[model samples]
Target chain A: MTSASPILIIGSMAFDDLELPTGSAHNVVGGSATYSAFAASVFAPVRVVAVVGDDFPEEMLGTMRGRGIDVDGVERASGKTFRWAGRYDTDLIHRTTLDTQLNVFASFNPKLPELYRDTPFVLLGNNHPALQLDVLEQTRAPLFVVADTMNFWISGEPQILASMLRRIDTLVVNDEEARQLSGIYNIRRAARDILTRGPRRVIIKRGEHGALLFDEDGIFAAPGFPLEDVIDPTGAGDSFAGGLLGYLSNQQQISALSLRRAMLHATATASFCVEAVGTQRIATITREDVAQRVDQIRSLYEFGASTM
Target chain B: MTSASPILIIGSMAFDDLELPTGSAHNVVGGSATYSAFAASVFAPVRVVAVVGDDFPEEMLGTMRGRGIDVDGVERASGKTFRWAGRYDTDLIHRTTLDTQLNVFASFNPKLPELYRDTPFVLLGNNHPALQLDVLEQTRAPLFVVADTMNFWISGEPQILASMLRRIDTLVVNDEEARQLSGIYNIRRAARDILTRGPRRVIIKRGEHGALLFDEDGIFAAPGFPLEDVIDPTGAGDSFAGGLLGYLSNQQQISALSLRRAMLHATATASFCVEAVGTQRIATITREDVAQRVDQIRSLYEFGASTM
Candidate 1:
């Protein structure tokens, strides 16, 4: 990994065969690690600690390295890479999973390299909480830690999820997952309930409604910029995590302002992700472009009073 | 009338008796007519065209008069006023409806006064489509027409609602209402669906997530300013309409800039409305205070970016 502050992302990096409106696009290099690493690297040089297989194309690896992403910890083994196929209807919100091949992902175990041990930022993508906790155990005193979980983990291993929640600095979850975890229909109350578990901060993303940031002080919201064309929403959550952690790692301090700015950047990144299928949209995001688009969003909110 | 502008409001004026942890308040004068007329009168003279009854309370009538709301067209017969009673759990999002009293509101008809027929602007509250159409029939070519509808109308009287949708220039609906109306689960599609019906513009308010504006050209979104304590959500929508139309009428321009600015003001006013139960928090609202809070909201979405 480069000498810059390392953000070790322990997640998936593989192929996403999408069955989109215009039919199928095969074996696009996707996975949370791919999306998040690109996003985080945009702000800080990142180390991806995940497993891939021989079938995983070399072009994808070359792409990450060219972007200044350190994939040395991305262990390459035998067999095939993880693959996911999904379709979006008119709802786009309610996507149906067509197929999931957990190839090399089945026996995946992350082991950070010696040079990456000092990595200060860590993002644990949705996985078995035991696996998440295992990664947490291996990492050094991380400057900031954020873990994402889903209903499967919450239902399958409640106790393990609870342990993982207690150890992290923040938990990023969808609104439904938040409700299922909190047992309350209202997301606001779900946020309050999640706070009781030990994490100082909680961010509940409302799909297209944008995302919410809730800490000890209160809740601040960042709305998703309205896009008429959002072809795919697959890696949106990972993209958000990348943007959030990327901004945080790029900052000098971790105050409320820093966190809030991070949230905004993450939100803007997610906005672009839904514009086209897969990672093609966010693949070329630059800080200048993100900032200018953020200005447009901010302009949508500016107002002046009438003295008359 | 103080002559700032004549405001016409075609909406419901009902009695909401809510049971909160703090205590229970009974038969309070609430609804779009009550809140919009009161909220708008802060900037303009208002005429409320809503149905009520003898049980609608003389004290409430005096209160409207106190606020300079012309309740001359508030048809008062010898029936009951619409009464809604809800009980909130610790998590305030899902409040169980303990009671719903559709009293005189069942056969309500909006009859505008002679002076109100010439009012420059109309703020339609969440009401029956036919009633809104009836009020629209009486008014002349208004400079600005703002409308609000609920899920009930979108589902039950869709045919009638679609017909009414053709008349208004702008629509203000909560996110669920937009989804229900559009029949598309994806938010951008939902906005497109509503725009298809006829209104030149649409604003989908996502409660605490802020609001999204959709028009023919494209779309924009504004984030909600976070608030610490949200005691009551009643009248927040109406207050939003009041703030939005109040600014629109005073500025005398319905450009995208003004509409967005009005949106922020409306969002800010709604923020204050949720601070206390019912309309208590909005009673003391002033334009000056609104300006300062609005600046705070503007600063929220501001972070200039340089080329990286």
Candidate 2:
């Protein structure tokens, strides 16, 4: 892998129909690769490898290019774009999927560009295990590789996911996915169990509760930014992964301290993602906005030691 | 209030029967006051003011006394003690209360000892707001008064609880209680709404998710220790309050920094509380253990500023 290699991201690029407690949005541009790429572009150049239908907005592709993202790898398939419709409960924690239309995405195959093959940092966004594995196979020896997945893949393609898990440096999943993958309810235990199966580090994302990073060095817990209003939560997880991998790629090193700071940055980025529908907030946020929120998050957990 | 006054605690003294995923324990000494007193005693002298029945074991009182708790105000009634039986789900988060026998606690009233009436630091444990008010009236002007309540009191005695809320400097409640009291589902919104009503600060305890401390300065979030095993979560909230107020009483000052440190100590204390049923782990933990855990927790969230 070359030192100048970009951060390669592979996942679905689609549209989302969200029914939130406060409001609803229809056919908003949303997807794992889209959010992750935008989030990572804030820290490092991002190359997105995913399929979208011809119906996908040309302006969205131009937006990615404007954000310094490499959109050449994004394929324009002939059919309808993947679409998801979900409704959030009053608590904004539980979500019920109303419908999932995987049109062009149903028979998708990620085709990495020749330049993307030499990428030193890679983020495999939430997707099928086989697809993630294919991307990994195509990439050169990455300095760091982080993979995010959901309960669907963990339960549906257990063997394939396990195989993919063995090759990644980090695994990111929500609390429920961690529990389902590890067969343990306690997050600490779940994380520890997942670490044994593969990945050097496991991050258990608890939404507004924050995230926990478990590795051999020890556990680092990052507090989520306390937002006064969260209009939408769609794509928050993808954005978090984006920010994390983005920061790591920029640093080109992995340590407990770096991971801790990256988590805070990731959390700040995700906070912005939830402030509006889809990637509206993240898209408009500058580095200054992310830095200010990161500072706030750092202050939120910083406590001087007691002399006693 | 006398400068040397011990931290006064008023709540139930009961026998708890707990059914956990690992095992079961019957007739274990458990109560808000008992846990709080023991936890607070680790940092400051604690005076417990509550009524227990003759059926309550004398050795339990001796144990408190051995731990340096003042029990002169723990009146011995002539009936069975308050008893509670609960079972924890496998997740160790959702607990089902099977039985609650008020017994001697039903008609009882707190009568603070002469020495305790002048205590400067007071912790009003989970009890009826009316009874808590009575205790407050008996105490001569405490320098710092913190109160804890549950969903039951929030829903059952809204007016009395609101009156109590107006008097305390700090209010501690679980996520559900905060939501119920403020009529807001979002935690940050709930905490801000609660702060507007009364108390200078509001700490929303999110069980396994740790806690959020909201005040005029801003908010402080503490992460829960990642424990591989959590035997029973009973009395965790009370112990957290105990550790918090205990540290505050020892410091004899309330600032943002002090509150942050107190939250860490409180988190460590609660971590030990869940290691065993009822107050078993908390009753035996030394100050050194708490300090070491606090250091560990501090490290868990510590990260230096990023260069970029």
Candidate 3:
């Protein structure tokens, strides 16, 4: 377990304005790579490959470096960083995208450092499928490769997404995106159809309902922790992916048992991610906090079998 | 377990026209009591108290008698039976109510047989909350009483529904209805708020995501079986209620362990109910079939703990 390799993560680094029912935060440090790298750094060494702008704060990078995350792959351009604005509905499930400015990320091309090329565990964060594929070509054969996508890529870049899907070991997408990708409303059938495209496993993230892992072995339904207050849900999914890959990178083999444990850890991390705007809660959570939440999750769903 | 009391079920007996993506069935046997009784009869003796019209088929009554269900409490009126027409969307989750002809059921009153009044277990099937309260008044103090309601009653008869809620042992409602009833979007919070109203337990059913049991002790999440083909989802909720109350009636005492098993059986029964229109699959399913599906559900969610 201690001999696991560092995890390579590539995606956008942005400043986001989020409006939630409870409150709102503007120009906060938020991005898929930032959230995933922070979450994964808790379990294993992480190398983040993303582009930011001159406008991006220095303290954010310092925070990542302080957490032992390698920032050598992060590139700083002359313009403003990626920016996004969104608002969550009263239910906190439906979110509206107010605006999205790609900025420096619009023409960004990830150049994996020589050191990151040998990283055994790679997480291709939510980005253009073409860009994800480009990163895939740069990295050597890794122990595992997991790719995340959304409805935009599934609909806009179907061919490139399909090509990228064929090369990844795992595909992570939310339930709605899964339905859109497979053209099947039933999640069980949708996951099965996606597996035919290539990924050995498909993880469908159902925010409040929890996550489901579908593979050849079988299906695993993980329970989502019930939260009394969720301020913002900006980076929960990315955090989930980070926790999962981080835990798996530490394992010698990814067995069903291991994947289940990873799912729980992922669930715990994502729970914290939504507790505040951006990654405030997840950024400060100790391993002990995660362990306690995992224990709570176990108790929430555990039921002893009765002799019939 | 053998000394368990019979279950008293009170609701409507209707003819339904169901249109799903796969196919459609017209004037089929349907109703909360009909579905619940058939599902409950497998576990315990069921006494159904409902109203139907002259057009109601004699064979349907014979079918109940054939399954060992007591129908002496069923009242015969002069007009046509209650009829409902609904169409399921492609997702099979959102359903459109095309027509609802209450007919005889509009002014019907449930006059329980003297024998049924003494039944220890009772299920107040989905109907007018006022009617459910009326039945509650007629019955003696039962060991357990479970009431099922829908959004229609929650919106139309909030005061009566609230009044009825205070007298029941458990409340079974789908996720959307739970939110509407509690005026809270979070299912966990909604269930918690419901417990304050009266029922000791609240079961929030999330169609594809499964069900969650919220009580004073804690929450227990049960996974829903994944079905590739769902012909019609008309009676799934009522069938779920039937399976749960039926199993509980057979237990000496309803413990959390027993409740979880009951949920599993309910889930399995509901799974079969949607396989075809109305109660087609549920009517023919044996206890062995339910047992097998319960086992499958266990395996679907079973995950071994890893030493992290």
Q: What is the docking quality class of candidate 1?
A: acceptable
Candidate 1 at A306: error in angstroms?
12
RMSD of 1: 4.8
Task: Report i-RMS for every model.
Answer: 5.7, 3.3, 2.8
What does the lDDT read for residue A87 in candidate 2?
99
TM-score of the A chain in candidate 3?
0.97
B1-308 per-residue lDDT for model 3 (tens digits): 25556999998889999888988889999999999999998788889999999999989999998877899999999999999999989888998999999999998888888888889889999888989999999999998999999888999999999999999999999988989999998777888999999999999898877788988778887788777777788888899999998888877478888887788889988899988878778888888899898988876666755444
Rank the models by lDDT, top first.
2, 3, 1
Model 2, runs deviating above 4 Å: A1-5, A304-308, B1-5, B304-308
Per-residue lDDT of candidate 3, residues A3-32 (tens digit): 656999998899999888988889999999
**Descending-DockQ candidate ranking:** 2, 3, 1
Candidate 2's displacement at residue A272, Å, is 0.4
Error of 1 at B18 (Å): 7.2
lDDT per residue (tens digit) for residues A215-304 in model 1? 864566676776668788878889899889988888845667778778878888777887777778777788887787766555444443
True contacts kept of each: 0.31, 0.71, 0.66
Residue range B177-202, candidate 1, lDDT tens digits: 88888887667788888898999999
The worst-scoring run of ten residues by lDDT in candidate 3 chain A lies at A299-308
